[model samples]
Target: MNQTDQLVDLKNLSPDALVDFLEGMGKEKFRADQILRWIYLRGVTDFSEMTDLAKSFREEISQRAIISFFTPETIEISSDGTRKFLFRLCDKRSVETVLIPMEGGRNTLCISTQVGCAMQCSFCLTGTFGLERNLTASEIVNQVCAVRKDYSVDNIVLMGMGEPLHNLENVVSALKILYASKGFDYGPRRVTLSTSGLVPEMLELGQRIKVNLAISLNATTDEVRDELMPVNRRYPLSELMQACRQFPLAPSQRITFEYILIRGVNDSQADAKRLVKLLHGIKAKVNLIPFNEHAGSAFQTPDENAIRAFQTYLLDRQIVAIRRAGKGLDISAACGQLKEKLENKLLGSGKESSLQGK
Candidate 1:
């Protein structure tokens, strides 16, 4: 093992924990805040760049700790201004992050919580790889840090590769850092975490954090959801809906239920009605995503008419619904959709034309 590999990752430490850590090292609490500001706010990596810290303190910590960031192995940019970053972690395992930009100055960055997902959602490509390992709090936070350095990311969604609720502890730690005034300084409204309806974690997250919560609820029935997402079998629709209703939200905020409209599977007007009834009492909005067809996927994207009808039914019933426009299709922008190992698989096949890296 290398020397840096054994060093403690400063990015993994939360604000209070960081202060406690510095105090144990014979440093002041304010110094921890300064280090956070320099690392997260100022994007400084080197200990020497922390000008406010004394030379002795900097040198001492530099020998025992490190601030690590994922230098993206490749960055693929679509014509529509959507950028996908394939990040290789310290373990040599890879993860992906996508940056989706919209008009009216909205830029949302999608980050992962795990390298691959265990949820095994039928339509999602990321889950096929199975669970590799849960990402550390540092790995999750570093995705935002790496992207923010190059692009303007105002909104963050924990929805790229894995189920956010699966890695609850690290995810919560990462959220604390993201919202810390001394750290990323992101407002609660500016960040959203999507989960595959992990019932227990949903309640825990509600009690702890104030960020927007999104449920990857692709179906209205327990039978359908079970086949679509394995998690539904464990925490059925009844439990999931109860948890959603109980999920605390600000008066102005609504829990976003992401319903991927798969043709003939869950895109019917009948299904739409079931969804409205299911979300009847809860403060909710629906993001209607037509399935993005990938290779070897049994699911097909809903026809334009069917998709419109589903959204119309919800809108007619006083439900907030919007059809998410597809972006970055050219690059197979969805993580785990293009290649098995991003760097190795494509190089052998010579399908590099689709992926333009920066």
Candidate 2:
């Protein structure tokens, strides 16, 4: 059977499933560990690179199954050393991933979980594109593996193109792969999954995985939240807050509330006070991401003084707040700026050709 026809995302399969598949193919069970190491640890795309395996075994594996790793079709490095990658998926759908180099020897890989987004958040460009498809578990894992091959990733942020909790199964599967000792082995503390408050999945994730949770709580009030993020309308602020309070957290672990600082929108002192009330009793940190303006986006970043005042209010009230510095804006690959430009090019061409013929 052609491996591609198997419909198994090798990255998604558990270690036992991988072993079973290899053994069923008449390959030694020990080869499973080696294959997993190559795919996850070494990030090898071609079977030929599995030098530990015998040539004949490699050839057989190559004939039967192939590893898939996305190569960056476009790479852009910001002046500050933040690198953005536009990766081409196997199905020709493109997604963006970013590597942000931080101080003290830390690097974070921002990974996407879907081709486009279904959340339709008013502030997010990816949501404007509409839902394309959920990336396979392997596809999600491959972003980390492929990017880490070039950069030493010390942390991961599921804050790219799509709403991760919306693609819960694949997200959890990828998280398991990352946590697996036989694979990447990244500790749960090193990974953060951000969601626009998908309540059911949030509860499920809290039970299944212990990774850090970042909620895109752009607004504190239900009326404002509904205006900013449509997902809020379905899962109201009260219910979402209840879910967060119920979400299991270690004594030291605190949920991260990501609030995009859109000028004149949710930046007021009143909003900050309301936010404090909303987050009452739950251990949480606020990430104040100043809006990174993208073309056609209706929002604008709040001024420095306003941001400082907002931070000061949170700090005075004992709410931990960190300002997320703007990065990768030059490449339009920063937070909330991942619309597939190639698709837009194709659409534009179609329109031009149609006009010419008419």
Candidate 3:
């Protein structure tokens, strides 16, 4: 490895890679598990604090390796107890991570896989920045480790700034470490990756990672989806649905279809019926997310009646449907509201509020 590369971020290496590094240093390979437990499960980032290792060995590791983590630039907490963390990466780029606390003491962390998104979904705020860069596997897992250092995180959702499938390899590698018993020890069922209908990579993810899959299916028709999510123009609804039907799902695992209910857009009775038909064969549940408006966005959240009617339509049709309550609306931490404040800074506008009451 080059001199720069030799300053390896130990958090970036997988269990096997850790073992390889130990073996190369003439140390026992089993020490990799000890390190993994300290760094991942225990949220210990300092090698010197891993007291189980010999003092000399720890010194050697401290010199050769680094536990890299993003610098938390800003942390905002809403009245509803949702916390949003904006992390500044090594390249000085920023990504947002959200912690949504549920009623049953479940804390689900929504982490970013990229700095900004390439998928220009008309309603999303992150799409405004276009593609910045894909986050490395270490950067991805670092969000979890960083968050766990403060909060007890039980679930993880790849529903932040970027489309995860757009950076498939890094995401998959991070998932391996997160799922491994020697690492984060998070079960596959607790980890969910949401996508904007990247069919090929979605299929590949199913075959490779056993984590839960959630697809952002905002619009029912291809014409509408083409306009809302430009990715739909490439992977149309028919092809995406077909791929979903064929996806290798583990026993009792059902795909989650996230339907954002935009006012006068995709929340009509007819749209609800079509959504049911579209998800006819797939073992899926619909999460009806009422649009969370941000600064400079034209979309409006559907009325409560409209949202209820749409969800009711699916429920009556015997399809499992849930109207997802907007979390951290006051803090702009809900879906698509992240990064609006940063964009405001870039645009030189002092307008800060992103909450538009439903």
Candidate 3 per-residue lDDT, tens place, 1-358, comes to 4575769888777777788988989999789989999888777878889999999999998888988766576788889899998776765567889999998998999999997789998888778768879999999999988888889999999999899999998898898889879877899999999999999898898888788999999999999999999999999999999999988888798999999899998989999989988998899999999999776888898888998899888999888998888889888876546565754463465433222220
lDDT of 2 by residue, 1-358 (tens): 6548764456766676678878887877788788889888877778888899999988876766667677786677888788888777765667888899888978999999988889988888887778879998888888888888878999999999899998988888788888877678899999999999989989988888789999999997898899999998899999999999999988999999999999999999999999999999999999999988877787998999999999999999999999988876676665546444544554576732111222
The lDDT per prediction is: 0.87, 0.83, 0.86
Which regions of candidate 2 fall more than 4 Å away from where they truly are? 1-3, 7-9, 23-30, 48-60, 336-358
TM-score of each: 0.95, 0.90, 0.92
Worst lDDT window (10 residues) for model 1? 349-358
Kindly list the per-residue Cα lDDT of model 1 for residues 1-358, writing each as its tens digit: 8897789898898887788888889887888879999999899999998988889888999998999987887887889989888887876677889999988878999898997788898887778878879999999999999998988889999988888888998998898899989888999999999999999999999998888999989998998999999999999999999999898888899999999999989988889989999998999999999888877698999899999999999999999998888888888875676435465466566655223342
Q: Which candidate has the highest lDDT of all?
A: 1
Index of the highest-TM-score prediction: 1
lDDT of 3: 0.86
Error of 2 at 349 (Å): 9.3
TM-score of 1: 0.95
Residue pairs that clash (backbone atoms under 3 angstroms), model 1: none
